[model samples]
Target: MVQKRKYAALFIGSALIVQGLTACSASNPNPNSTGTPVATGTAGDKAQTSTSGEKVTLRVMDWADSEKPFREKFIKDFEAKYPNIKIEYTLMSVDQFQNTITTAIKSGDAPDLYPIPGNMSLSMAVKGEWYQPLDPYIDDAFKNQFAEGAFVEGSTMLNGKIYSIPAMASVPSTLVFYNKQLFRDAGLDPENPPKTYTEFRQAAKKITEAGKGKAYGIIEGGKQIGRWKLAAMDWSALGGSGLNQQSPISLVTHDANYDGKEVLDVMNVFKGLKDDGSFHPKTMSISAPEARALFGEGQAGFILQGEWSIGVWKRDNPNLDFGVMAPPVPDAGQKGFLPRSSYSPWIGMSKTTKHPKEAALYLKEYFNKDYQSVLVKAGDRFSILKEVNESSSEIPQFKQYYDIAQKYSRLVPNPQIRNPELASVYGNYKDVQPGVGDILQGVVAGAIKEPNTALKQFSDIVDKSLDTAIAKAKSEGAKVDKNDFIFSNWSSDKNYSQQDYKSIQ
Candidate 1:
């Protein structure tokens, strides 16, 4: 996935010698009456000291929007503060960021900071000693700025140290966004949206019947490799916790009903939607961008999107009338659980970095409230601070999403990195596909044998995969227990009487 750099430049370094004076051939003799030249320090010393009159350049990399004007504005203000430091930003695509960052790390030329996705690979990040720990730099003052559970204990936390800081945290699971116009055209009430799964299905069905070839009730992304997205979404929306205290461990090697019922129940809903022809046929191959585009163009009615899609949708279709709401739960009595979705994008220092203090100063100052507010306005990312999120005035489009995120977000502890051997036991998107495809194809094809068997096989594969990964991690000296993967505890404003805040694991 490495894109070739079209332009390249090379520089050769060597010791510098003062040339003889030309023109007037004038030379100043030492005041001590000894003809001697000044001493020159080592190359390392030269690098350590910034030129007195020149600026020190700090390089930054990100996969998010590079052209967003807010970033440029932030840099201008940052430069004004540190007149001697120049910030250079490089942007890359998320798909290619890993390879790109790896290359930079190898050359010891990566930017001062960049975001890393929150999947299984992050586990390796800590294990491989690629990141610099922030414990020394982080005091109550620094930690207080971020919200609680913004950093998962064992997952993002490694070896009793916090190595990364999630840039813009979001509710990763439990919310679904729908189109207003489509709902209206289908004779469904736009203002009071669905609050239960039954209502959701009914609303989707109405849209399909009214739309004909124009629209679909819902779009299923799980049919393709995007099933992970579906799993995450359902895990939260359905209020299914991951491995945790109250929930305890569900041994994949021995238990039959550990993780199956919840996963299957979520899958069956989509299978029903697919069978009903409520989903677009093109969903299997559609990427996230494609889904966004389809929603923007008003081709779909209800979409399972989050705050991340808000900014893009507004930009793409400013005229479109849209509304945001929590993904409907099973009943009004049961408040919906919004799964914390994406891995909190982290800003980690290089373990091999020689300028730890300087880097900390940059992060502490640069990512402080002022600039972070700029990021919140420009991007759809939620702030990591409670004060900032609660007091937000700008970005009206994202207000609802931010509010729900602050209140109902939860997470699962299952790691999501890629490992070769475990891929067979757990299966990848390819394994998830046939089962989901069978459900979809069966719904459209009027066959149950394939979808049911495929789903059971798929679940077995996932269970086995988890078992393999756990064993592998143990062999590698990881201090992992079954409880580590469970999410028995949960916190919410409605669940508890305390007015401060609550967390659901």
Candidate 2:
């Protein structure tokens, strides 16, 4: 549900526009119930309560279509509590969000708060002065309500100052969502899903064969650049590939070996599916949402998506019986692990906003535990808070994915946590052309004949890109090195915690 966004910055040949703020503050603070969010303090750390009876409209923008239902009602309630403040919320499309936000900032028309675009890095956003530091509006008691490690330096907090708050759990990745009826029609046990690569391939083949042009083995949005790898990464990550779900660069090696055993093995499975005609006819042309719709319509036997489908399908097709499970491994045994990095920042306050207090208040109310519960029920994703997840048992399907993400999730080494200065080092690397996603898409689409050569070339490009990024960072006086990116002592089998970074040395 928390879609992976690439860091892409748009340049309009102008500096970040700035607007002068007329200093205003409110006195006193109080802790309130779930309906009424925590009150702010006069101290800069606490958000100043907006007491001016003047009417104000605060602008907000985000791509979380999954959270729209709760967010809309939350906004309406918030307006009821603060009659003078009206929220103009914009739910932007995931694909166009980055470009639109960047253009808005360039034009000095940015929303009150917006998530850092996929193509833009937090450091770059901060360095560009696109967001104002949030420490002045939020206090410790407010932050303490979040789960452990929610406010991470170099992520939510940079240089001891907070910039953004994580809105969703970071653990959920792609999973197998299969139609029970389709599995039964294929002569497969709808209760027992495939666990091994062979079994998965055979099941898909059987499903396709049984459909007789009525359906396919599995459906995917192949037209999108990242769709293929989004599902395939689960196979690679769970099959001892050390695949960093967020990026191609492995946390263990801090480099990529796309042509290595982990990736190649998974590629073979997808290739086999393609050769066997187990993919939907429109798989290569449809978008991910379209593929999900078709899957919901029983046009395919299975789909690889996030747990958000639990809530989505429940609302759209309450009678639809879909079983959820992890993706198949190379064999029955597991080889690799999934990285559960600390909470990643979700949205930040715009520097040019006129109503910082109102915007900060909205963010607080929107990301609280109350909203987190809504998140779980919506099946859009899990909450960042541990208590919210622990309290959720009624939603069994969503709970299943939560359990899966927790079982395999490990605390991987973070180069930025080890060296906060790596913020610049991180934002320096450029996206390699024909990336892992594109390469896999091309292979499955039958456009590429030599995956070996392409994978190796990609690995080489990653190495060069890492080297160039380090060199560029050094030139920029970041005080970073390639070794900072490497954690030779860290194992893929176990977690590398914050304390481990110190202990390893």
Candidate 3:
């Protein structure tokens, strides 16, 4: 008998780093200088200060406009605690952050500290030395404060060094948030939510039939091709395909399994939903915000979204009554799971910063339990600290969210999806004709009659792209092999593991 894999025991591994030296020339001299002798120390060591009495201001940059409240509080608390250090907070839009940071770094005007943008691969940033390693400041005692496995390989640790520290826990990419009143109006049981894909489909059909053309069973941002593909893969993963969370390149390159009946079933579900007219009529045309508005206004019964939606919907539609549920599974008895990447964007300092000691002190305060508590209470995001999670009664709503996260979520390893060179190559291919998103959109729009055919085309494109990337990497004398792409012992039923890739190295 084949040994069935278990979800709880999976441990994701760090990707092997092929180090190359790169240097950044300073364009701005003494960017963090206030002529102050600030205190700094390793994790367990007592912070020591110099005799200089001048104050130091640390410039911090991030695209977290919505987290203004938490940011304000953090700065206030941090400044109050450390009178010699002041934080200069700079906010940029997500679209502009990557370019802004890149330009700033190249021109030697980078902030003393900043978040690694979600769109920028961490490996690439590390390779370019965009962020200074935090290893020297972080000792075992400091690292012990975080939950076990909080320090992920690709995002924080690369080439045996700690580059960044995660500020938030891994959040589930897909969750079912349904309006309770809408379910009741549709003659469905609000308390007994969907447990499997079959029940979810039946409920959607019933809700749509009950709408009398005024409401929809589900609402999605179909006009946003990337988001649409994400939803498709999220739902597909719910059917036990496991390929949903992996990048398109990973699928074709065999870093993730692409050939499975469950994968095909996911495509069929999308087609069936379209055929059944279960989606909002404007789903294929409207943006995510518009779709969200429709759902908030009680024009849709259900919407698949992330934890962030709860606060938004509550604020925008104060009267609407809704509840959250885990994503459905392939069968009733099988446990449903939410897919989360092991690594999240972390806060890191720049190598060019002149105030390393003060900056490191600020990092320590930033992730302190007190600050984390304030952040959790403000609902900015969940904390990476284990104590904060254990003492979550301080924020009841967040505690509830944490419960769901702990119960239903599992982390997908980062290395395969986060390989910098491969990701860059895949990103370029994604813009060309017959891209993965294009194929998914075509299938959903009924243009591609056969999902298998479209998927085959997608796989072929991925194969060629992977071949070129691997060849280039090898020619550059990078230590990589085809074996890195294959995980023969992996089981879709279990959470992904580092052991899956151990043999390749």
Cα lDDT of model 3 by residue, 240-274, tens digit: 55543334334223642333455566566667777
The 10 consecutive residues of candidate 1 with the worst lDDT sum are: 14-23
For model 3, name the residue pairs that clash: none
Whole-model Cα lDDT of every candidate shown, in order: 0.47, 0.66, 0.55
Listed in order, each prediction's TM-score against the native is 0.66, 0.87, 0.72
**What is the clash count of model 2?**
10
Judging by lDDT against the true structure, name the best candidate: 2
lDDT of 1 at 362: 59
lDDT tens per residue, model 1, 329-398: 5543443454333234256777776556555655666546654554445334556665665554244657
The candidate scoring highest on TM-score is: 2
- Order the candidate numbers by lDDT, best to worst: 2, 3, 1
Off by over 4 Å in 3: 1-57, 80-109, 137-140, 152-155, 196-202, 205-215, 221-226, 244-264, 271-299, 311-319, 329-340, 377-380, 393-409, 412-454, 496-505
Better of 1 and 3 by TM-score: 3
RMSD of each: 15.8, 7.3, 9.3
What tens-digit string does per-residue lDDT give for candidate 2 at 179-207? 88989998999989998888988999999
